[model samples]
Target chain A: MSTVRVENIKKTYEKGQVLALDDVSFEVKSGELFGLIGPDGAGKTSLFRILTTLLVPDAGRAEVAGLDVVKDLWKIRQIVGYMPGKFSLYQDLSIEENLNFFATVFNTTVAKNYHLIEEIYVQIEPFKHRLAGKLSGGMKQKLALCCALIHEPKVLFLDEPTTGVDPVSRKEFWDMLDRLKARGITIVVSTPYMDEASRCDRIALIQKGKILELDTLEQIIARHAQNLYAVDADNRYNLMNDLRKNTEIVSAFAFGEEQHVTLPPHFQDEYLSAFLKEKGHTGIKVRKIAPTIEDTFIKLMLENQ
Target chain B: MRNLVFLLQKEFRQIFRNPTILRMILIMPIMQLIVIPLAADYEIKHISISVVDQDHSTYSSKLVNKMTASGYFQLVEYTQSYAQATKTVGDGKTDLILTIPAHFERDLIKFNKAQLHLAADAVNGVRAGLGTAYAAQMIGDFNREIREEWMLLPKFNEMPQIEITSANWYNPHFDYHLFMVPGILAILVTMVGAFLTALNIVAEKEVGTIEQINVTPLKKHEFILGKLIPFWVLGMVSITLGMIVTFVIFRFLPVGSFFTIYAFSAVYMFGVLGIGLLISTFADTQQQATLFAFFCMMVFILLGGLYTPIESMPEWAQWLTRINPPAYFIKIIRAVYIKGSAFSDLIPEFLVMIAFAVGFNALAVFNYRKRSA
Candidate 1:
């Protein structure tokens, strides 16, 4: 059964001048870890708000746990947990107080749902008496997650839960989500970081208020992957410019110190080396590379434009 | 039921944690009660007078002495020429100018009438009007005294004397503070309730906490009641503090039972707090909420009939006051504090307070959308 179903969702701002979400559709299977992967301003937050019942879509329908988001909002609110993109817990409230308050609001108790948040709670439990505003970014995110999970919600929606968190804490947060999935709670999370896409069971690559691709990590790469190569030389900038001018290269982008370029299938490295030597390039090295999620996302975004 | 209790607990915790709220609740009443009533006094005294006595007779000097003796006027200038006195008033040294004409005593004895030209600087309307009335009243008393002394009880004049004695009820001494304390208390409670409740929801919006609350199963009325109850309690605390301050400083207490004051205030605060919650619904940030509440409060307090009587106001202003919630509360408080009016005597105002309480709160709840548009 689908935990969430969204169809033809449309939203706008400033009296429809700015299109926030346009003709969006998706579904999350029960107990699946689904991700909406995009950069900032990709309408990730709008979709999350629609599913959480915090916002009403301009057109189309969305359901959470088999209830209409607009009509059965109160029922949906009871069964779903939503952590907005912003750090929204009360700043003046202590960490424990914030958790207890949310539990009580959902007609539960902290002691009753302790197991659900025990792993993440133990990490930050020492400073539970500290005001939420005083906690570090990682600790704050952990507390927010605990609050969102205190009710043992059937579906959890976390919008950019690890956006500003440190890498170590980000990995720990994903680990907690994986454990929650083990317990059969469907999770729908969004992230601007493309590396996080690989962690989701399935993800939809979205850009400019439209989903470019939706599939598992391996499938998305295998279907859209091109004959990609990573090339490096002493003068990185000059190599990138020379590679972009080559007619044989399909697309070229600077990926850190190397230039990742897609060329015609079965293209020989020696042919590129010969061409670069004639152009007075030196110390050139080329190797075939598997496409990353970022590489495929960039390619799809370019094609969609 | 459980949700409301938890929400109220959180709200009260937040209120106690904020130092600004503590200061507003504890210090505002004492400051406003002691300061506003003392400064808002309207009884005029020690009006500067410059008398120009051209008659140079015993009656003229006696009249000037009598004016100084009344204790309401200060004889700043006792010049002979009217121009000199006029110049003193022009320079702002004096507030009133009196010109006694030549042969002023002879005219009263010969023609049974006398004319004294009195010119007052009408810049400060209340002071000028009251000073002129005071000076004219002293002159009239002098005329009566002279007649009685000259004619020996009016047996020869064949005139019947009608004596008028009037009494000031409620406030026999006409104490200005007695009238002002209750009105100021009404305003203080109103400000605390409206401003604090106004800021509550918008602060959550600004900090992004309201988004978390909206996603929960908590009902909308539960959320609104959570916001209203804490501020209502604080408003009552403010009124109680104001009463204590009033009694301590002015030795004044309400003439009616304390039950009436609290009963009326409990209902009135719901209306004021409703207005605050209503403002919160229209604003997106704390700054917007504060500005909007301030605008509403300025209109409410100005036309509230605290400084000016509603009957004396222009027709349009009085019409506006009819809709102002604070105006109704002020009138109710004044009646209970001064007139010792019972609950039965104030049934109409009680009904109005109930209507306001129900009306504003219903609109607030109706406007408060759990889901964003």
Candidate 2:
């Protein structure tokens, strides 16, 4: 059974002038770690808000844990724990107070759910007497997670939790999420970081309130029909400029140290290397490589445009 | 019910944790109750007058003496020439110039009438108007005293005179603070209820914590009740504090039952806190809510008959007070405190308060969107 199901959800803002979510629909299976991958203002937060019962979708039905979002919002609220993108715990409240408050409000206590948040809470336990606002970003993240899990929610929704976090803490947060998922909790998280997509069981790539693709990391990359090659040369900018000026290349962008490009059916890497050498005599390397989720997102964006 | 208890606990914790808000809840209202009524005393005390006695008759001198003895006026200058007295008025030395005409005493004995020229500097209009009215009353009393003297000496023509006796019943001394303390207490309570509640939900939204709370299973009415009850208690606390200050400094006590005052305040808190909630619902930020609540509070207090009587206001402003929640509280508070009025006498205001409590709260709760539009 699906833990969460959304069908034809649409949302708009600014009196319907800006389309925030456009007929967006997807499903998260029970106990699956699902990621909504998109850029800023790409309707990721809008979708999360709808699924968590914080918002009403314009034109669709969303069900969480077998209950309709709109009709059974109270029931959905109990089963889902939502961590908004911003740090929202009361600044004046001590860390322990914040945890206890969230737990008590949920009609549960920290001790009742102690084993669930035990791992994360221990990391923040030393600073339990400190104000929640005065904690470091990583500690705050853990505290937020602990609060969210205090009631042992069946599903958890995290919106851009690791956006501003350091890479090390980001990895730590993901690891903590992995343990929660092991306990059979369905996790739905949205992030703009393409690298995090690889950690999820399935991901729905959304943009402009529309879902472009929904599949696993391997499946999304495998589904890319065009062959991709990484082009490297001494002058990275010039290589991208030259590749873009050529009509034979489907799309070309400088990705870190090399340029990633898609090719036409008959395009050859040897020919491209020879062409770049002809323009400016230098050593060049061109080779085929697996596309990342970001590369796939760019390909999907180009196809839609 | 469980949700409400938890939510209230959270709100109270947050309120107590913030020292600034705690000060606002505890100290600011007490200070205002102490300071505002002192500056708000509207009674015109002493008006200086320059008298020009064109006629050096006994009655003219007696009238000047009567004006000076009234305690409301001071004889700043006694000049034979009107020009010198006008110079005193021009120098801002005296607030008014009183000129006695040439025939002063003979006319009152013969024609039973004499007119005095009184010119008041009307810059402070209320002061000038009340001073002139007071001077006129004093002159009338002087005329009656002379008439009574003439009647005792067996006048040739004893024209029948009507006597008017006036009494100041409720406040015999017309103590301004006695009249004002109850109204000030009502205002302090109104401000506490309105301003604090106006900022409550919006402050949560401003800090982005409202989204977290919204995602919880807390029911809408439970959340509103949670927010409402804490500030309702604070509102009553402000009134109680103001009453204590009123008692301490002014030695003034509410003439009516303390139960009546508290009962009315409890009901009035519902209406005032409803106003606060209504403000919070319409405002998105704490600053916006504060600005809006401040503006509305200014209008409500000014029109509330706290410092001024509503009967003396223009037709439309008096009408505006009908919708203002504080106005009814002010009236009921004054009626109960000064008039020793019973609950039945305040039934109309009580009914209006109940309506305001329900009406504003209903609109506020309706506007509090639990599910985002």
Q: Which candidate is the best by lDDT?
A: 1
What lDDT score is found at residue B124 in candidate 1?
92
Ten-residue region with minimum lDDT total, candidate 1 chain B = B151-160
Kindly list the interface RMSD, in angstroms, of each predicted candidate in the order they appear.
1.3, 1.7
Chain B, TM-score, each prediction? 0.93, 0.88
Give the deviation of candidate 2 from the true structure as CA RMSD.
3.8
TM-score of chain A of each: 0.98, 0.98
For this target, which candidate reaches the highest DockQ against the unseen true structure? Answer: 1
Residue-level lDDT of model 1, residues B131-152, one tens digit each, is: 9998888888988889888778
Q: Highest TM-score among the candidates is held by which one? A: 1
Candidate 1 Cα outliers beyond 4 Å, as residue runs = A227-254, A257-289, B49-69, B74-94, B97-123, B139-163
Q: Which ten residues in a row have the lowest lDDT in candidate 2 chain A?
A: A264-273
Q: Which stretches of candidate 2 lie over 4 Å from their true place?
A: A225-249, A257-265, A270-289, B46-124, B135-165, B344-348
lDDT of 1 by residue, A1-305 (tens): 89899999999989999999999998999999999999999999999999999889999999888999999998999999998889999999999999999999999999998999999999999998999999999999999999999999999999999999999999989999999999999999999999999899999998888988899999999999688888888888889889989998888999988888888888877777787788888898888899999999988988888
Shift in Å, residue A154, candidate 1:
1.5
TM-score of 2: 0.88
Global CA lDDT of candidate 1, please?
0.91
